[model samples]
Each structure stands twice: as structure tokens, then as C-alpha cells.
Target: MSTAAANEADAGGHELRDLVTGLGRAFGGALVFSLPMLMTMEMWELGFAMERWRLLLLLASSLPMLMFLSHYSGFEATWGWKDDLRDVAIAYGIALLSSTILLFVLGVIGPGMRAPELVGKIVIHAIPAALGALLGRSQFGQSDEEEEEEREQSYGSELGIMAAGSLYLGLNVAPTEEMILIAFRMTDWQSLALIALSLLLMHGFVFASEFKGSEATPDTPWWSAFLRFTTVGYAIALAISCYVLWTFGRFDGLSFSTALGVLVVLGFPAAIGAAAARLIL
Candidate 1:
């Protein structure tokens, strides 16, 4: 081959290799991040027992979130809406395949199961698995340039990231019975204290810590950051927590007080997740 043709062939080979490596990372991330949920009994039961409409809604809602996440940080560097959409599709596909294989290997899925049960189980788990696949680039493959770009994101994009983080962590624990049991055991005063703690932790994680991803600066006031990012993030966390709970039918017949307690309980972790999102993602 001529020199120019040889160079062109090398470039093509490099591109193909990078694509394969990214796909492998995405698959690894999907399995690693979702393994806990895959093994959880509640998650397994929720797959088949949850309402069909709720399941569909969960699946539909994940698409936009995945698209937005892909825009910010995907399995590959995306330049436009088309790229983001393609990444979302790839991540979802990886999630579905990974979930099915793991569930089958674990004996959670089998030959005798009905279609809805089998599909439901896989679909429900795929939401978080897809999120993990998209996050693979951010967590395991982020370049310095990408990190800098993320740091320069707008306030709205920052909030979007927080919401994504909140949903990711909330989904992990939302399907469990322990959330309700903890809420039921706590007193009203304890619930209030938990809310205060969540807010404080959320604020501290982003603003007070000297972590590498901390957005705070000497010139920026603590209260300013608290009000702008921390409080808003906590609110987003609560909203996401409520939505996850509702999606799982956890609030179907509960009273106002009980539901509020459960919301607060879940919000604790979600709030922390939201705060840490800026640092981690």
C-alpha cells in the first residue's frame, strides 16, 4: 500500500479498537453497577408484581434521562443530538442483554416463566443498567478535557446531573421493603431530624469538603453555594425519591404522614447521591 493509504488504514484500525474498548467498558459498568439490584429479592419480585402501566412509565421516562446523560457523558464522546441518541440506544441495548444474561445465570429467570414476568424482570433492571452503561465513560474513561467541560456546565445542566444522580441511587434502594419499615419505625421528630441531616450532608459534600471535584472557591460564599446547589439538589433528591417510590407502588395506599416519612427516609441517600454526583460524574 502507498504511505497515505497505510496511514489511513492505521487510523481506521485505531477507531475500531477504541469503539470495542468503549463497548467493553459499558458492558462491564452495566453489570458492576446493577449487580446489587439484580440479586435483591425485592427487585426480582417488583419486576413481575409491579403494575404494567408503572413499568411502562418507568421505561419511557428513562429514555429522556438517558439521552440527557449521554449528552453530558456517554459511552463515547458525543457531539450532537444524533450522537446522544445513538449512545442512549447502545446503552439500553447493553443493559437489556446484560440483565437477561445475569438474571438467567442467577436462576432468577428460567424456561418455565411467563413472558410478562420474564420481560418485566429484565426491563425493570435495565433502567439502572442503562444508566450505568452511560456512566461508564464518566466513571472509568473520562479524559481531562471532558472533566473540564463538565465543570463549565450551566446551572440547569448541573441540576440535571444532580437529578440523574439522585434517581440512580434512589432506584437502588427503592424496591426494598426496608425503606417502608424504617419509615414506619421512625418518629415524626426523627424524620424531621433526618431531613435536616440530609440537607447538611448534601451541602457539606460539595461546598465544605476539599475534594477534587468541589465547585467551591475562596471568593464564593458558603451560603451562596448552599442555596444555589445544595438546597436545590436536596429538593431534586426528594422529588426523585417520591417519583421512584410512586413508580414502585410504595405509596399506593399509604396515609399522608407515612408517605412523607418514607420520602424523607429515601431522600437521605438520594440527597447524598445528588451532592456527590458533581464530584464523581
Candidate 2:
């Protein structure tokens, strides 16, 4: 075959593969994501968490990332690492925004609801996303399960609904003071945790679905991938913390509480990614 024809054939092969992966991801999420809900309702006996319920409503609400990521990962794997990283950034970014939006909507719709408390629950719950990101990242450079894990290791902003809540709480009453005080509130452990858990769950589920693929790859061993993901994420987080401290850290305006609060809020996704890497990857 001519060189030109050979290249074309290789390129064609890649496109076909990505199409398969994308379909696999979308269809997989569609099939499985809702499984958790039924188990959740049965487990907790709670109603669906959404604007309204319809058959598969919550799953319908959720699972785009599943389709997106499966296709995303499959495409990336078939295509290149750069694409995979881009997918991760986009997926996580959307996740962060969505969770923040939901918190506000819930706060507004449920008058009796304690908004701050709701935020906290979200962070804790999102532990999964952290798992997934790391899980996904770990796959980037890894070895297959054939090698035993010789080692072990571990480890967004803003919706006005939050602003309105702050006002209701007290900050909103005034405007300038409210903004600053509300910034502090954003750092709260509760708010921080909720964001963390919420992001974690979304990503975690996606990563877990892909876990099998990573392990099957000769380079990607399960435990090592998890440990590596945690280390890398923590390293990045630390560097960011330092930058924040150097820039905003000194001012009394930015206290430990604020820092911790921000970390928890932002770190929530990291936690989820790391966990997913560790557990699922």
C-alpha cells in the first residue's frame, strides 16, 4: 500500500474506535446510573431529588457526562492524551457549576430548608468525583494488574441563591459587608463539604464505569493509579494553596477559615477524583 493510503487507513481506524467508545459510554451510563437511584430510594426511602419526577427522571437529569465521558475517554484513548485532559477539565468544570446551581435552587424552592446544611451534605456525598478524576488521570500512565501493587497511598463558585441566603442570614441586609461576609461563609466547612461530595459523586460514577478499561490496559494497575492520582492532585492543591496564601493569604481578610473553606469547596472535586482513582481505577 502507498504511504498516503496507509495513513488514511490508520486514521479511519481511530475514528471508528472513538465512535464505538462514545456509544459505549452513553449507553452504559443510560443503563447503569439510575441503578443507584432505585437502590438509593430503597436504601434511604427518600423521594427523587429533582425539579419533578418522571420515569427515569433523575437519571435522565444526570447521565450526560456518562455518555460524554465514555465517548470522551474512548475518544481520548483512541485519539490522544491531550483530548483526554481536555475532557477532564470540561467535565469537572461543568460538574462544579451544576452542583452550585442545585444548592441554590433547593434553598429557594424549599423555604423551610436550611441552605447551609444542604451545602455540607453535598460535599461529603461528592467523595466519588475525586475518585473518578484521579482514577481517570491514573490511567494516563500506568501498568496492568499483572503487577501487584507493591505500594499504597491515599488522599467554582457562586450562585446568587447563596447570596440571597447570606442576605436572609444577615450579610445581604447590608450590601458591601454582605459580600465580604458571604465570602467568608463560602469557606465554611459545611459549604465546602457539600460542594466536595456533590462533585465527587457525579465524576465518581463516570470513572467507576471506566475502571474496567484502565485495569485491562497493560500499563494501568488499579492501586498504583489511585495512589499516583492522589499524590499528583495533592501536589497541585498545595501549590495552589501556596499561591493563594502568598497573594491573599496574609490579609486578615483571608483567614484560615476562609482558606480551609475554599480548599474544601474546591478540594471536593479533587477528593472525588482521587478517591475514584484509588477505588475504581
Candidate 3:
């Protein structure tokens, strides 16, 4: 067999190699994604200019992260980034299209969207989903049967990671019970817990939806329908945020454009960070 296949087979035996490699990919992916989120928030909230050159520089830096994860110790990619990317492309396409239709039908979105802004939003958001799915697929390759099994095995890991990453990400914006009172208009510990609880519910909604019917076969869709629902719903929330521009529009100034670049550009890092943080850490 080819060297690639040999490594794939070997990874099954060498768990440490796979774990280490996955760790690299996941952290790399998270860094790529998180940077944009951090930058955008800082820019919008703090009134810093999101320099185009800075974005470019960040992109250039992300390639190495992708390559590193792509070439880590036990990462036996059956198909290169192309295949995972292809998966991402399909998933995001379906998501964006459906979400767009839903928005138009619901009348939740219009007026503020110029053609240019619409296209920009598409490129920005779609790229991150593509990267998230791609890196995740590459870092954690499994057949339909395997993906299902992984889903089951992933339960504990998922719960833990959600606690960390969600808390980490939310702290910057929502401020968990540990430190939320100073931020938004929320109350005490209960409110913070509820927010995290909602995301967990969202994740369960996504996983359960994917874990059903014929689609739940070994080829369980990467961008599962429920996953799409969560994303599209999130996107719609952002749209409503635009509408809220007239109301509590402070966050309208908060941006995620920076996080998008890091995330879309590097696939495995963010996914792995999430997985590792949840499971191992």
C-alpha cells in the first residue's frame, strides 16, 4: 500500500501520535478562528481600525498553522484539505442558501443589505464554516460507522470542551456568572448559566438531528442539517442585530470579521482546540 495508507493504518495503533497531531490541528484551528473574533470585537468596541494589511498578515500566518496540522504526526488524511474543504463547501452552500431564503420569507432581513454587503457577508461567514468543517474532518477522520461511534465517544469530551470554549468565548462578550454583572444587562449566575445551557441545548439539537435516520449512516453529513439550522439561526440573529441597530445596538459595533479570517484560513486548529479543551483538558 502507499505511504499514506500505511500511516492511516498505523494511526489506529499509535493513539498518542494521533492525539498529539490532533492537538496541534485543533489549537491551530482555534487560534485562526479566535483571532478574527478577538480582532473584530476589539476593533468595533475599542474603535480600532481593522487594517487590511493586518488581515493579510494574519492570513499569511495562518497557512503555516494549517500546514502544520495537515502534516502533524499521525494525521492520515485520506484526501487532502481539498476533500474536507469540498465537504465544507457543500455544507456551507446549503446552509447559506437555505438561511437566505428563510430570512427573506420571514421578512427578518432586508433594507440594510446592499448587494456588496450581502456578498461580503457570504464570503466571510461561509469561509469560516468551510474551515471549521474541513479542519474538523481532517483532524478526526472516520467512516460513517466511525463518525457515529466518534459521536458517541465524543459525548464526554463535548461537554467538557463546551464548558471551556464557551466560557472563554462568552467571557469576552457575555461574561459568565463568574464575571458577567459588569457587562451586559443580564442578572446573576442563573442568567450566565442559562446562556451556556442554551448553547449546550443547541449542540444537542444539532447532534441529535444528525444522529437520525438514513443520513445517520456512516456518511453522516459533516455539515449536518441540524448543524446548519444552528448556524443559520445564528446568522439570522446577527441579521436581527442589524435591525437592533436602532435599539440596543452597542454590539453592532462589535465585529467578528477578524475571527472569520483566522478560522476560514486554518481548518484543524480551532476544531482541535475545541476537542482537546473539552476532552483532554
Candidate 4:
């Protein structure tokens, strides 16, 4: 081969190696994120028993969500939209494979299991597992520049991150009856207090109650940041909570006031997730 051809071959080989490494990382991430659900009897039952339409819809929605996650933080650093699409595909594939291996080892699957049953089980669990793969690099990778950039992120960028984080974390809790139950017990005054608490906690973690590496950027006025980041972050969290509740059929029989209370209840954790997103994501 000519020297140029040999160099081309070398570059291709390096790219192949990187891709393999990235997939390996994604597999590990999928394990960490999916293990809990894989082991949970409730999750397994949901996988097997969930309505066909809901399951299919959830599976279909995961691709776009994964693509969005890949845009912000993925196992591989993407160069373009095509690259992000590719990474999202690979992340889901890794999720399927990792979930299968773990479930099989856990005795959740046996040789005699039917094809549709096996597929449903793996596919359902892989949703969050794949997302975990998409977010794994950001949580695990060590880069001072990335951390510094996150610390000093613009208000708009922080709002975007908060939205993503709120949605991501809210999904985990939204399907449960506990949100509605908690809402049922709380009075109107209590709901109002919860909202106020969510905003204050978001403010403290993101701007005040200083922890190392959690300080604000210079020239960021206190009240402006409070209004923009804290208030907006809580709003995003509350919105995500309501949307997830609706998507999961949790709002099917609820009255408006009851639904508002549920939103407030779930918004608490969603807000915390949003506040910690900058540090974590």
C-alpha cells in the first residue's frame, strides 16, 4: 500500500478503537443505572404487564430523548447531528445488551422465555439504562474545563440544563401513586409552602449555601440570578412534574386542585435534581 493509504488505514483503525471504547463505557454505565430496576419486582412486572400502547410509545419516545441527551452529554463526543444519532443508537444497543446480561444472571430470564416477553422486558428496562449510558460520560469524566464551564454557565444555558435534569429525574417518580397520595394529605397552605420551599432550596444549592466549586460566576447579581435561575428552575421542575404525571396516566381521574398538589409534591425532587444538574451533568 502507498504511504497515504497506510495513513488512512491507521486513522480508520483509531476511530474503530475509540468507538469500541465508547461502547464499553456505555455498557458499564447501563449496568450502573439499570441494575436497580432490573432487580426490582415492580419494574419487571411493569415490563411484562404494561399496556402495549404505553410501552410502545415509551420505547419510541426514548430515541429522541437519547438523541437530545447525546447532544449535551454522551459516551462519545459527537461532531455533528449524524454522530449524535449514531451515539444514541449505540447507547440503546448497549442498554439492551447490558440489561440482558444482567437480567439473565439475575435469573429474570431463562432459556424457555418467549421472544416477545424477553424483548418487552429488556426494552422497557433499557430506556433508563440507555439514558444512563448517554449521561455516564458527563458524570464520570474528569475535566477541569468542563467543570469550570458548568460553574460559570449562562442563565439560559443553566435553564436548559435544569429543564433536562428535571425531566430526567421526574420520570422516575411520576408513575407512582405516592405523588397523588401526598397531594391528597396536604392542605392548600401546605402546597403553597412546598412551592416556596422548592424555590428556596433551588436557590441555596445553585447560588448560596456555598460549597466548593458551586460558587456563582463573577458579575452575576444576586437578585437577578435568583429570579432567573431559581424561579425559572422551579417553574421548569414543576412543569416537568405535571407533564410526566399526565404522560403516565396519573392525572386521568384527578381534579385540577388535586393535580396541582401532585405537581407541587413531585416538584420538590425535580427542583433538587435541577439544582444539582450543573454539578452532576
Top TM-score hit = 1
Candidate 2 deviant stretches above 4 angstroms: 1-21, 24-72, 79-232, 237-257, 264-269
Candidate 4 Cα misplacement greater than 4 A, ranges: 1-17, 109-117, 142-157, 208-216
Q: On residues 18-132, what C-alpha lDDT tens digit does candidate 1 reach at each position?
A: 7997898899889877999999999999999999999999999989889888887677777788989889999999999999999999999999999999999999999999999
Candidate 2 residue-wise lDDT, 204-267, digit = tens:
4435645443322335564464344333444443333333223222223566766455444444
Candidate 1 has which clashing residue pairs, if any?
A: none
Alpha-carbon runs more than 4 Å astray in model 3: 1-78, 120-144, 147-281
Candidates sorted by TM-score, best first? 1, 4, 3, 2
lDDT of 3 by residue, 1-281 (tens): 99999998888767776556544554444334333433343322221222334334433433433333332211234245674444334434533454344334544336776654444333332323323432453344544543443323233333333333332233233211222122344344544454344445454544544443222333656566435433433333333222222121233343364222222212122222332333322
- Lowest-lDDT window of 10 residues in candidate 1? 207-216
C-alpha lDDT of all candidate models, in order: 0.88, 0.35, 0.36, 0.76
| lDDT at position 83, candidate 3 | 47
- Higher-scoring candidate on lDDT, 3 or 4: 4
For each of the candidates, the C-alpha root-mean-square deviation to the true structure, in angstroms, is: 1.8, 15.8, 15.8, 3.9
> Per model, how many backbone clashes are there?
0, 34, 20, 0
Position 102, candidate 2: lDDT: 45
Candidate 4 lDDT over residue span 200-274, tens digit each: 888888654342233355467878768777888888898878766765667788899888888889999999888
Off by over 4 Å in 1: 143-151, 208-216
Kindly provide the TM-score of model 3 when superposed on the true structure, using C-alpha atoms: 0.30
